[model samples]
Target: MIRAYHQPSAVEEALALVARGAVPVAGATGLYTGRSRREAELVDLTGLGLDTIGIHDDRIEIGATVSLQQLAMASSLPGMEGARLRRCCRHVASRPLRNMITAAGNVAHSVYWADLPVALLALDASLEVRRVGASPALVPIADATHGGKHAWDGGLITRIVVPRRAGTLSFGYERFTRTATDYSLSTACVTLRVDGSSARDVRFVVGAVSARPTRLVPVEAALEGSALSDDAISRALAALDRELPIAPNYRAPAEYRRELTQVLARRALETARTWAARENP
Candidate 1:
């Protein structure tokens, strides 16, 4: 159980508490969801003023305390980034839960089965964190989640930053579950830039079945410079099944997840195509 709760008034104070074994909490969604078993002191992060969302140098900087409901507001998102964020945030959960979950917390906790991290991963997002007794550094979303090379390691994630594309960019995100509000059994996201009819800079991320979101590199490489056609999409699906290895669980068999991955991948590609057409046409 949490023995004490401390709401530090400054960012440095929070970092100090984190270095001393106190758990820093912005949203505490995962903390209270039985995911965090061991607890020390709860360092409340709300008082540190890490709740602003702003655009600087075409980068969207979201405070660690920004809630899902706040991000779900489409009007607040400036461009394609806003549209993509709203698209994913709307499916997060009911109103009350969205209000309680923080965007940075969503990425920081690295819940493999969650949506926000998967979406952000596909968007090529990064986090700004302050480590104990160290200068703040920006870590890629991939590394921060899933214990990648640059792990969070008890650091306080202060903000989430993603680039704003200056040109036409197509992207899509989709998740599969037993129900609309249920945690996804698997999730996929796609982002690509189009050069005429050819797909370029393709990023395909699959999540929820593993400890971290993964890039479908083989599939992405297959579609990288090719025209997105029915045959190509089918080939990409084949490559996904052939190249992406999945582990089975009681809730979802490996075969089932493999097939579901294809379905979600196709849907995301279709969504990307649709948006690309709209932006390019």
Candidate 2:
């Protein structure tokens, strides 16, 4: 049996309640497990009415309680960064799931092969973290946690801020899994800034192959300022092969994951280059 439920109207009050025993819920998307037990104190963040989206200075701030559907269904955004990330949101779980899943909840309890973190990482998104008494601070998407996980301790995620420069990035992702809803067996997010045929900067991230999604910096370094020729692709792939050491999984071996990650990274770069050409031309 659940003990109490509170729906505060203010962010601070909500934080106070959340700092107590209550767990904040935006859409109740992950609240149940087909008749499983429920948390004792449920903090209903929906009533806080934190849902809003807009550009502030150079970052787009997205409320934590905002639904995935709301983000995906928005007609106009100033840039492709939000739109591209929203496209990934549309592919998450299903339409109904998107309608209910909250951005805060999704990242707070990110599981294997989750969508938001992968895309957020690519966009260089930052999190607006608020606590009961402390003023909110922005943490980079890559370092949003205490011990390298997304747990906010006693803090609440008010919104996610994606920097405007994030839009300048071109990206692609690949998921090798059984079904659309099934968590990715392995997933990759590739982003790069290109000028004509030259790579200005690059980042490659792979999910479900480690304790957390990891950035392939060596792969990025290898591709930086390099033209997407056969030799460049080969070198990037080789760099990934040397840098990424995958752990064994029940479904596949470590060697297999390393191979898959390398292949996926190459393919993602190829696709991202194609996307850049279309977007830039």
Best by lDDT: 1
Per-residue lDDT tens digits for candidate 2, residues 157-247, read 9888987774345777877766777666677778777687677667778887875677778888877888767788788888878887566
Displacement of residue 202 (Cα, Å) in model 2 is 1.5
Positional deviation of 43 in candidate 1, in angstroms?
0.3
| Local accuracy by lDDT, each model | 0.81, 0.76
Error of 1 at 189 (Å): 1.0
Per-residue lDDT of 140-225 in model 1, one digit per residue for the tens?
88666442534666778898998876667888888887976788888888888888888888888888877777887888987888
- Which runs in model 1 stand beyond 4 Å of their true positions? 32-36, 145-150
**Highest TM-score among the candidates is held by which one?**
1
- Measured on C-alpha atoms, candidate 1 has an lDDT of 0.81
What number of backbone clashes does candidate 2 have, counting pairs of residues 3 or more apart or in separate chains? 0
Minimal lDDT window, size 10, model 1? 144-153
